[model samples]
Target chain A: MSAAPVLCFDLGGTRMRAALLAPDGTRLAAVEAPTPAREGVGAVLDGLCALALRCRDTGVAPQAAGLCAPGPLDAPGGRMLAPPTLLGWRDVPVSALLGERLGLPVLLENDANAAAVGEQLYGAGQGAGSLVFVTVSTGIGGGVIVDGHVLRGRGGLAGEIGHMKIAEHSTDCACGAQGCFEALASGTALGWRAARVMRARKDGTPPPSGRDVIEAARRGERLARRLVAEHGRWLGRGFANLLHLYAPDVLVMGGGLANGFDLLEPAIRAEIARSAMPSYRETPLLSAALGDAAGLVGMAHIVRQSLPDLGRERKLG
Target chain B: MSAAPVLCFDLGGTRMRAALLAPDGTRLAAVEAPTPAREGVGAVLDGLCALALRCRDTGVAPQAAGLCAPGPLDAPGGRMLAPPTLLGWRDVPVSALLGERLGLPVLLENDANAAAVGEQLYGAGQGAGSLVFVTVSTGIGGGVIVDGHVLRGRGGLAGEIGHMKIAEHSTDCACGAQGCFEALASGTALGWRAARVMRARKDGTPPPSGRDVIEAARRGERLARRLVAEHGRWLGRGFANLLHLYAPDVLVMGGGLANGFDLLEPAIRAEIARSAMPSYRETPLLSAALGDAAGLVGMAHIVRQSLPDLGRERKLG
Candidate 1:
């Protein structure tokens, strides 16, 4: 591994996380800011440019930088396509703009694919020959790794797990599909289930969010516990379906909802046991080790692999 | 490639087809007979021995034999584990028994996987680096080839595509799953749908079977045509799902139902166009080039690969 430090960014619609990661995989410096999603693509690019510059000012001239951002990315061209999550952002030449502003070679990767690479290299998926990483948040997204390389599919959309339909839910998904796994098992779905199953607490607290529902269940609330279990069951069903499809060596869960993994693992396992054949049932499902920072971990390698001459380019320039 | 000829068998519940294939992928001799399934394992072995002896009499001393059978197989142990399609077939030591009877080494393979290998090598999937082959017979089974090798899942059941759930259909599948692809769109399902829509022929013939239904549609029977289209729709949905999962270089359809490819291809493409990303949509859906002879084609290679020393043994013996 190169001794040179690398800049990493995990950009999402709601937030952007930037970090300077040393060769030791330690974050030397980190910063976060709300994404200027509604302010238009130009404003968002300016924000990112400023963020990268601020990190570069930390008395360290990073050799290269990597940005892990939301998809439908035109990865080969280093462009960000219009993703519904990013509002009106479309056809932004991300790497060129940021590289020009920061004076460093930059590599752009899909966020979910980056996270999978991160997990495979430095977290729960180490030593696994094949893995599928599913992140359950407001929407469920995924990344698949096969034979030690991230599977990008033909369009670099191989891990769009959220759009895979699981069952007919009472409501349709934002994807215009009925009964998507995300519409059933995402934090968004859990919040709706929690709201319907449990009334306001006697303490007169605010409305229950998905995290509140997890907390309520952790506190041994009966309806909340059952509702969480129900969520876990759906999660397990999706896992089973994926197991049948990929037969991955490991299935790792990340994102915010995975924080409640303790309450969900059993139900998930049970449903998987029920659905998957005995041969496919052995793949372990585990929580991601890197937590919130997982998305950018792969950026280091991405920069190195895609731009091996970064240091030479900078010196010559 | 060796100049050694190999014996191959494609065994099913209804029949057993055998052939001696030369080094250049040509059939030296071939024969077919009823499976003798109702006569128990002993009779089945005896019949297979007789068939092998007859083929051997044609002056082809084969290096080894390969058998492709219905699965839920203990492939490593060379045992058949009660596939629902084959009655009374449980824990049959196929390789050992057949090898002993024929006085040659034997290798066992799942029929669909073998067919996929056949297609990948000598049929529509030729030259494709990655392929997904679906066999639509009485049921839907599949084989996935990636990086030039068949993907055998954890227990060698990786390509059981028929069991994948589609949506809630009116009936349950033989696999005890509701709305399985087989339950909704297989030839068996088409037969039932055809029976429902059309009465017995005016010539006082019995209710039309699945093949009869296809024949009627080919002749432009209105209700049969509509029912066949519905089957095509479901097939398209399954194709879309597989595209998202595999993003294979080519998709090949084999088995009896693929005979109706002219009827199903349009709808399959339409659903795929609607559901798959543009890049994945480019993968061609083509009929398997080998037709009904595909199952045993891969067996020749399987025998060669698994028993590489068979030639030496034959010479020494």
Candidate 2:
């Protein structure tokens, strides 16, 4: 019998990517489009409908569809529940709407979780049973896979590692929390710090982006270097907390900031090495292999696994 | 048919409790013994052997045995790895040794992880699909349960919540790290804080125990009350971190300090309400139902789940 194919969609705050995956996890076809999130969730659904129709026109019939989105999403309900990234997406019935529009089964997952599943099945965490995937882009996001299953708590809201408090008495978090790890180590936070340092300089140099901060640090800019080191230190602090709390065998770092992981790896690792339980020091920390496409591939797997009725019954275990 | 029985032991630094639970999760008999851990792990093992004999006397044939011990213990290898409480136990093959002595399969688990499994299957988390158990006693311990499986990291060393960094610029932890949750909000830390404040009194009053601090707070002792409140606030800070990271539907608070949870609930919830992502504001913070017995029962469930050759398997999912 021929293996079933699933449609995978990775939804970012601004862009959307679609892919077709065969049962053995082959990416057969792929395409991209703008999310149009500011036009509201209804318009975003309309865009997804058009994308799904376009993918269908490429001669591959999708047995099921999978969508990965910014979370606080309710995976069980296939709903996007109040994600900060998707404007006007409060309590949106994402999977149901997509399934109805496309006339196929659909599964919804947090993008980080999808990335984690992607890493575990086809990327850095291949063959690993327990893993934690951290995406450090504009913001820090994480997904935990334990005993070969995504650890989705009630309402499918588990794996919110970015918000874990790593710094004590530091800046306030966007979530109204004081000293959240995200407020210190996220890419946005790093950029914000760099810009603030530049503005405070007596030399009156213009502020820079997070990437510019890395470049400046490499070029021996004292404040920029300090900012990067501080971010790395906090990343290490957060990683230490994660090690203590999850103890996963593999920690996979991904997303845009990871492109220059060397800038942060030393200080980040130093903090973890100095702080985590000595016995757990052996756990490997590596860079994600799939990069941006991890979410799409991960969502493909989620569709296959969650919608067994679609008939691709390969055992993940 | 009568259900097979399993022998379970909860081994603490000072106390050890043993019980026999039927496959149906009924406790046939249970007893407590002094751990004498200061004498070293050998004496503790001997005590375990004696406890096995006691279980035999109850006429409940234990097909398998499980021990809930302080971790970095190896669950798969069944070894008592270096645990803080078991100072002398280093790479001891506890399960194999006990299996040989008792003529039954044996398994080992971190006490908190065991408690989490026990709670999920038989206590407050019984009906819940996923949960995180946090126990704030002399120290803090945490366990994560997802999809009815206990998450043991690569080396069976997951769930070390107490060691997570809480304060970036605070005191050192027992694990040779700075600003761990254990260093700031554990009962041990609470006692230390109370003692430090009392020592500064001109009246030469000795520092009180953690329980005394709680009592003093109840009696409106100004300094003690303030310190206790501060401890609760710090604890709340850690809880906020846990909520943000895991997003469990229920947060089960256990251990000795949880006895005062009623008094501390408001402050802890207030902190979490203020610090956590707005979406997680509603997660329940409740006291554990099983208390010390949670460890023993959790051990039984571990044996039932992990050792299929043993007859006590049906109780586990």
Candidate 3:
């Protein structure tokens, strides 16, 4: 591996994280700030550039950079296509703008895709020829790797697992669809279910957030436990669909909800055992290893790979 | 393109079809026979070899051969792993056995994958960079093509779309799963639904086959039309899931049921319009162009591609 480092950014709806990562994936410097999404695309882009400069000023001049953001993205074109969370950011040419401002070649990837690559190369999915990585946070998202590369279908829109409809009929998803996997099983869905149950009790207890429900379950609350189990059941159903579709070498679970994976594993496993075909029943499922750092590390590697000349030049400030 | 011909075979539970196909996918000669499934593996292999010999005698000697079969296959190893349809056969090395018998290297592929490749190369999916093909016959099976190659996940079982659990709860599938896409929307499922409705009516009429239901629907029978529409709704739900997962350039529908695609297209389209994420809503839905000849033509091209040396040799018998 080259000793040269790359700047990496993980741009999310809530926060934007930047890091200066060595070629081997060590973070030499890192910084994060709340996203100015409501202020429009220009402000968010400016903030991202400022963070990149901060990481660059840490006395280790980076050669290239990689940025991972929410999709729907035109990855090859390096444009973000109106992601729900990134308000007012429609068809923004992020990669070109960032590269032009920083004077470095930058590669843009979907956040979930970057995370999948990160886990595959340095985390739980290491050595797996193909992997399916799913992150269950406020909503669900996923990425797929096949034959050591991300499976980017037409328009680089493959691996949009959250929008997959898993139920015959149920709640509508934010994407304007009914019975979507994310609609039924996301953290938001769990909170919604909890709120409905609380409302039905007539005890005047306020509705809990998704995090609160998880914490309540961790504290041995019966209702919270049942709710979590139900969430796991939906997750397992979606997981079974992924298994059938990808038959991946490994399936990695990540994101906020995965913090309580132990509590969810039994229900998830049971549902998968009931739904997946016999041949797929033995597929290994594991929690992600790199956690929050996955996107940064993954993007760093992607940039290094995309701009091989950066490693050879090794320009020092 | 090489002028040499290749032999192709599509082996199914009910029948086995063989053809001598030119490099351009023309059928120089064709033959088929009922599969002797009850006569054991050896008999089936012998029958397959006999059919190959008959095709070889058609004055156009094939350079190589490709065979497609129902899967759960170890495709790299060229072995079939106990497909439910092919009773009494487990881990049968069809490629090696056929190659040895014919003195030609034979390539084995999953039937659905072969069909998908066929459609992409020479059928409705022509010019598409990637495609998802679903064949809703006795059961619903699928194949995915990405960047012009088959998406063969681990064990070559990636295209088992039939078993994806689409319903939260429903009747059990032959594979012992409840609410599978196949269990809810397959031709067999349609027959089951028709039978239940007929029994409820008590009009002294015998139960209708899935084909009878389709024919009745085509002839404008109310009950049969409703059944077909319901089937289409289930199909659309499954199609939406596929759209979200692959976002393929095109989606091809084939198999026996595809003969009635015109009847089903309206409902399928409506459900997709309602359920699919907007980005994927415009993916072209097409009927397979080559009909039953798709597998044969596709396998011929695959054989040509896999054994490039065969084209150079110009073996004329």
For candidate 3, write residues B72-140 as lDDT tens digits: 788778788887787788889988888788887778888888899899999999999999999888888
lDDT of each candidate versus the true structure: 0.80, 0.81, 0.87
Q: What is the C-alpha RMSD of each candidate to the true structure, in Å?
A: 4.2, 3.8, 3.4
* lDDT tens readout by residue for model 2, A120-167: 999999988889999887778899998788877767767788778776
Candidate 3, residues A121-230, lDDT tens digits: the string is 99999999999999988789999999998888888888899988888666778887778889898888888999999999877988887778889999999999999899
In model 1, which regions exceed 4 Å deviation? A1-6, A22-24, A54-64, A102-104, A168-170, A194-209, A301-317, B1-3, B22-24, B58-61, B100-105, B195-208, B273-282, B301-317
Residue pairs with clashing backbones, model 3 = none
On TM-score, the leading prediction is 3
Q: Candidate 1 vs candidate 2: which has greater TM-score?
A: 2
What TM-score would every model get versus the actual structure?
A: 0.86, 0.92, 0.94
- Superposed by TM-score, candidate 3 places the C-alpha of residue B218 at a distance from the truth, in angstroms, of 2.1
Cα distance off (Å), candidate 2, residue B238: 1.7
Q: Candidate 1 DockQ score? A: 0.34
Residue A307, candidate 2: C-alpha displacement in angstroms: 2.7
Per-candidate clashes come to 0, 0, 0
